[model samples]
Target: MSVRTQESALRIALVFPGQGAQHPRMAAGLYGHEAVFTAAMDEALELLGADGERIRSAWLARTTTADFDDVTVSQPLLYAVDHALGRMVLDWGVEPVALMGHSVGELVAATLAGVVGFADGIRLMRARIRQFAQTPAGGMLAVAAGLGEVEDLLTGQVHLAAVNARRQLLLAGEREPLDRAAQALRERGIVCRDARARQAFHSPVVDEAVEASMPDWLATPLNRPRRTVYSAYTQGVLTDDTALDHRFWARQAAETVHFAPTLDRLLADHDCLLVEAGPGNSLSTVARRHPAVVRGGSEVAPLLPDGAQDDVRDRRSVAAAKERILPLQQPVRA
Candidate 1:
């Protein structure tokens, strides 16, 4: 299952989603069906204690009132589910050649890549959730504009949180300013949608949180990734000179996620399958729509779809991965 083994026919790329993709009962299908997934979830729950129990209960209940959107719960839960799904994919015989994660999802990639151990990664995620929970209530808005247009809309109140695509931008800040910006954009006939986030993430609004969490992040040990890991912060492949220290994560918390550029890099350089190992196919859809992906001819697939039957989704994922790894046929003529 070592990603570096180099025996697999397909060059697989594992991609994870960040926050906002979480739902009330994500990964319910895989929980008991996949042993590796179950083991990973159990380990994470044991580490998380009561908080983990709450999340697990919500995820398992046939019906219940659970707030999956709370930052404190969502971040760690997403990490655990994503990590378990990646492990399940490995168990299915597809080894990743590289890994990429958007926003908080990077922690999962880091842990799987050996950049950080599972226990330590969970601790960091918990510390991060605590730090962010202290921030004043805020929200995020997605506007249909390019970077320059979005930047012009910033009035010392809001900051660009993510550049998802060529013209897709996310802004985060205090609720009032964000609402005002959204109204203004709509008045101009632009499409804007509320992201429904409880706090402003990946913006200057979280600067204080970033500063407060520095000591914990710095104290955590990290190592070079065993597999290639692209950084959404840098929008490029992580290098030896790139520091995975506290300063790096501090900046990550307060800076825009350059996801489009990072995807472009992966598409341009790697003949790999883009496998979204998360609850939804949103990132997979984004990757499929990218020009580089269309031009370069890389396959994009999701491990699961929203609200799909458990057995169907699992079967589809296995079929897709197996098809991708099949060797090219030899010339028929003798």
Candidate 2:
């Protein structure tokens, strides 16, 4: 295909990974190295108040102020990093056809799309922490098996949490029960790993907590997305009404995430250059398994290094992605 033909066929979609993608000091490489990203991230942290400062400290120091998956640190830091990266992408002059996010990343998508103000999004996350405080302590498990293969194992406390890709599934439950479930899956020769989660999100354990937090929202009217925003939770394009539904947001953690189905729908709409605009490359890793990407109908770019802190490498990755998306325009770096 000619350059023009290939460019014409491109439909860019910015995808953000959620909770489990967080690591100690994730995306530290880009903290002060990239101007646009640094400013946006700082703004996000500032809105988060004192807690944001603490999170920033840990992130920059490559240490943890609390459990890596604790709601206080992980959720806020992940949200800030993902949001900042999205802003950086927008600054590149490339318009995304859609914004999609997994789990908490969906809120980041919603914030960027104008469905909710950024501060309001942060408040909702805070409310989530407060409300879930009373719930039973729980966690999530990442399993390398299809839902159909493991659905029967979810008992009273255990439940299917998320469908990341074709065979990658997530299970959530109270800690003890989740551990038992993992053991059972292992006995059946299925690979399983504990997700970095301090709570059993997307499980019944948090249902009542979610219900109690439904009223926790500002009176500010929700806005329509400036661009298309696909929802992993609903597995469809998010409607304006759903965006305005506080109850819907409240029940998010008590429901399963249909990320794979949503990705299928997003891809069916058009082939895309799927960019991972968050810490690590988990979503990009998942997207690579999709048929269109494997068939060369789509491309994927992850902006940060996967396993370690490398400021220079991070800048190079962003610069590389910038070139891939906008060859004629020079990036802020390189």
Candidate 3:
């Protein structure tokens, strides 16, 4: 019996962030360099029956605030940025062996996997964002420097959102519950930091959103992915025949993400290069700091908000990141 060997290939994992990562300037730089990226942005505007330029400008406003806080804006913006960056990577001849998205980012990953089309994805995202945005007055916060200290402090009122590492944890719920949890953590000498989003994602508060958004979710066609896509909900990779159904993804907005465990399996399977394909270095920051990860992607620019400077895109950062990935891109040990 000849057993197949899954060689440690130079595998790429194109990752995107959840709604919390949305920014006003998302996907600004890829306008010219990546065609699909630009097309996705245009499609988003057109699908919503809005003027493309005006919509883009309103999102790119001078205020240092995010337009994505508006579900109408965030749903499309995140999809556009992630798809655009993935398109650019494809153009560069780099195909990811796997894909993953954090919370809402999973929708983008679904699109990349061909689990959904760009237009249908935009429509569904719009509905989903609206539901989540309307999730009553509640939100999420991050507690830094140890889950053990914070876990004991969390009462049943609030739920743990994500455990990024041993020391980093995210808690989400109504503001009051989060406040209580944060206060308790502080008493235990834990440093708590909050993410800059207006709503609590991946927690039970958005159950209403999930229920109401189901119609639109099912209306969208599910397609087969071009590759394997890992689920934040299931804490593992989704195979060709199965993935989180529409309802599962919708419910995800109201559940906690099992990020650390999902990542543990991803890194164990391949020679991973985790690229922050969308806005901000939030996910990249976690990956580099996580004990499970070692070498990762070189670029660290948010995919949107045109013209945000990237240290990685600079001549020097490119060289440094490339140096780390060079061996994997080639076959021989140099």
Give each model's clash number: 0, 0, 14
Give the TM-score of each candidate. Answer: 0.89, 0.93, 0.83
Poorest lDDT segment (10 consecutive residues) of candidate 1 = 325-334
Candidate 3 lDDT score relative to the true structure: 0.66
After best superposition, candidate 2 residue 320: deviation in angstroms?
Answer: 1.2
Query: What's model 3's TM-score?
Result: 0.83
Q: Which parts of model 1 have CA positions greater than 4 angstroms off?
A: 1-10, 61-66, 307-334
TM-score pick, better of 2 and 3: 2
C-alpha lDDT values of all predictions: 0.77, 0.82, 0.66
Top candidate, metric lDDT: 2
Clash pairs, model 1 backbone:
none
The sequence of per-residue lDDT tens digits that candidate 2 reaches over residues 97-169 is 8899998889889888998888887777666667876788899999999978887888677999999998999
Superior by TM-score: candidate 1 or candidate 2: 2
Q: lDDT per residue, candidate 1, 64-128, as tens digits? A: 34455667877888899899988887777665778999887887887888887899878877787
